[model samples]
Target: MPNKKNFFLTCAVLAVTLTAGCSSGADAETSEAGVDSVAESVGDAKGGSSKSPADSDTGRPRIRLDTTQFEEIRMYQGYLRCLKDHGVPISVKGNKMPEADPGTLWFPNIDVAEERPEVEKACLGKKPLHPPELDPQKNPDYMDDYSKWIACDNRRGLKVDPLPDGGGWNYKPGVTQPRNADQIDKECMIEAFGGE
Candidate 1:
């Protein structure tokens, strides 16, 4: 989930950016299956040594998997975030950059087969239990008609940025406007995202 502003922007943007909706299927059972498959491969590759050099000091090995490239690929980020949020100890290896994919996540404490369901239910559910503000689709306060509404911001003496077609508005970085920015932002959102 994203913050309020980001959430609204994403809602507007996603209509353009994503051609298909996503499916969230990771659960304890699926996680266990994935872990077993990886474990077998790793076991064979390193004589069943699950410990990597980084985690060897702890004597508790971790299961790592190469995941997708885009952090905007919310499915993986949401899954990992859900795992951590629910107190499942996880370690992400490699540099995390939005543009870079194939990062790894390691589960240190989970007995992949036994705890997979708990993780799925707690952190891998259909919605992944994001904070309320992060999900604009569920937020009662979110606005929608950004195209016509942005004009209101421009008229209010706010230095507003343009919205891309089928996308949301973003302020040009480092730009300044009125001192009452907080209120102005709310007004802008209301105007931009409100019904036509």
Candidate 2:
């Protein structure tokens, strides 16, 4: 029997090369697509590292996520790192993201977002890092908490409001000069990052 690992590798390589070969004409096949095209459509979540998904510019395609390759990528540190390396933006259904890649926050269109000097500068060309393993997204309480935080961050012009200078539990705004992490509430970072 063929080695399973080698089999998958061969499949991926053939897919990439064939894709490149077919598109050399610069005309994307407009017909209905298969799994390869589906990867192209998902915006190539290959953002954690340098390698981009094939045909990233092609219109977005819906991903089944049930595929073996996707399952591997979802669990692969290197793949998530590639997403960050390439500056591909990631956006999750909620803030829930891969625990293995902490620094890799979810934002849409990572490729474009990476072009922004800020992210490029922030990443410092270093290997992508996943955020700390957060509370389980599957938990009902965490889901509720996630929604609350999302809503709170959605509140326009959310300023950092820490204790002693503002409301106890309720954050007060208009506190000129938002200070560092030590001076702000824990929620400030989440808010500043747009609740990502």
Candidate 3:
């Protein structure tokens, strides 16, 4: 069994892998089962909701995960702005938002655990909603879907190999990825995993 620290690290790496569509130098030995375990642990930690807030008709604000990484970064900037406006003392570097701590993706870095409630209340509507297709717990077909995502990338001329068993992909070692690779990745991700 993976320890909590390693699991959180895997989650962080997985997030980067998903966004970048390439290995972030994480262990290639990390298995699909390990990812499943992490997803299950996260679901358990969050009380195992049967329906995500996006799926529920509960009158909650829900942002889709169908956007590009650039768009998502813009949203994160808004979240940081909201936190600072709410007196969270978040630090920003030039125009970029601060990196999220592992396992607390999208949440601002608050030093005190007791401040979470206040942060949550202040940033209620700005939280990013994970689409079911992109969520391992919600989509048991996540690996297969990722394989299709690789196929989509290949179709778009990205010439990358999907990591064995579906964790991520890597560019051909000697080949230079295109200058517009980011745009291609955004389009492929939307086609492969974006939710309606």
Candidate 4:
């Protein structure tokens, strides 16, 4: 039950880490083009926020929408299907999305550089949008919201120790994470970050 945000962050971090090892010759341009396409679509949306910060690399404004777990799963499944359809050799089993875990959807042997263009094409509009309020660059109140999330986690038996100066937090050193850590994270995230 890890929150959608955490799951998305985990997947993004994993993707970046894995892709960093591959050669970045033409893939970089392809990836940027995909990002630009998403930015255009988001910027064109009706009633979208005008306060989105511009990306440093592309100089395009980033427009992100708050999304729920179900929405994210649906989008991810579609992207996976698209990849399969585009001959990326990924297997999409059933309709259910995989659990939000690091190794769950990981394909270690996949040649990211070779497949990157196809991935970009398939996932053009399928990237999970970040909520602006949760983005530190966009929201002045990010630290406050993060602190609330930390407090919520602690109250729920996660025992997180927040770093000083609005830095991030880590689990209390000796305390092992509970078996239901994901559930706690999910509930606390909703409590701290979800708009009422």
Candidate 5:
């Protein structure tokens, strides 16, 4: 039979050995995991051209993922304006640049707008949301022919619709006729010119 001191000493040594082994194993695993994650992060950081650090003089890769949604600036401004006109508070929708489609622009997770019936009405016949003047597909004030439309803008032809079918007839601040395209009492502008 072992003495009491010897037995206690053996137990202590065993415990220390087990703990040291487990910690060393854990540290090795952690180091391997960290290296793997760093490599993955650098790989994902590659930009459109997929250049490496040594490939260019920059010694760093730029990442610009084209994965973003769409946003209609004019329509959102109108929405906010309409809310202010009606004495209601307005909030921002998505902060990211919305993705582009054939016609629709998607902005997900708009806050404080869920309870607004006016905003809901504003978004009718379209996804996400947009003010009326912006939706050429639905605005009664603007006729549709895809031709007679003129994009009057202080910021170039960023917007397009029939010229005389102009509902937002008067814009404030910086404003002027379109430098890109012009139109008159034409197809969609029929109603805009007092219905043909």
Candidate 6:
């Protein structure tokens, strides 16, 4: 079986890659809930290190947290550090990374918010990382069901885009919908599709 952290890192990397250069309006509350859940699952209650390094761009030290279980985050952090070293503007969600833990981390698309052509060019030179295989089959019935699910969300006052023509599902793109679209209660989907 795949390591669970690797699995999530793969999924998150894929999501981030697909949505690269797109501005994010992530739902702060929803994201906090996820972090809290992860913290609980990992038995960690401590917040990340306090006091960003004095040289940090915001004149505030960068937050650091231990992410021992998710090793891939270290590389992402290295990437961010590289960008910062090269004068690229970046921001981490909630301004934190797990203390001492490295291997995976999350950040908004700096490319979308910053205009550092040199830094962007440098980032492009690095090899791109791909997520593990997660192909979801898209048969007609699934598409039809997804359509209904989207409709249900719309009816419930959740803003969701229509699934593309083939109507396949992937991590959603763009910030036009709710920040928590990925975690919208599946009970609504169940109510809409009802086992199809």
Model 4, 26-141: lDDT tens per residue? 11122222232333323455665433222232332122233333333333444344455566666432333344433223222354435576565435453434445556777777
lDDT of 5 by residue, 14-40 (tens): 212221100000111111111100112
Task: Point to the candidate with the largest lDDT.
Answer: 3
Candidate 2 per-residue C-alpha lDDT over 41-70 given as tens digits, one digit per residue, 9 for 90 to 100: 233466443322332323322212122222
User: Candidate 1 lDDT, tens digit per residue, 32-143?
Assistant: 2111111222366545656332221121111111111122233344455556766777766444332334454533344433666665544423222222322345545433
For residues 100-166, write the lDDT of model 6, one tens digit per residue: 3343345545442256665644443221232111112423365555567667666655554553652
For TM-score, candidate 2 versus 4, the one ahead is: 4
Q: Cα-based RMSD of the predictions, in order? A: 17.0, 20.3, 12.5, 11.2, 31.3, 16.3
lDDT value for model 2: 0.29
* lDDT value, residue 64 of candidate 4: 28
lDDT of 3 at 8: 14
How good is model 2 by TM-score? Answer: 0.20
Candidate 1 off by > 4 Å:
1-5, 8-144, 172-175
Better of 1 and 6 by TM-score: 1
Q: Pull out the clashing pairs in model 5.
A: 69-98, 69-99, 70-98, 70-99, 149-161, 149-162, 150-163
Q: Is candidate 1 or candidate 3 better by TM-score?
A: 3
- Candidate 1 minimal-lDDT segment of 10 residues: 60-69
Distance from true location, Cα of 27 in model 6, Å: 28
lDDT of each: 0.38, 0.29, 0.45, 0.44, 0.27, 0.36
Instruction: Evaluate model 5: give its TM-score.
Output: 0.17
The TM-score of predicted model 6 comes to 0.30
Flag regions of model 2 displaced more than 4 Å: 1-137, 143-173, 182-196
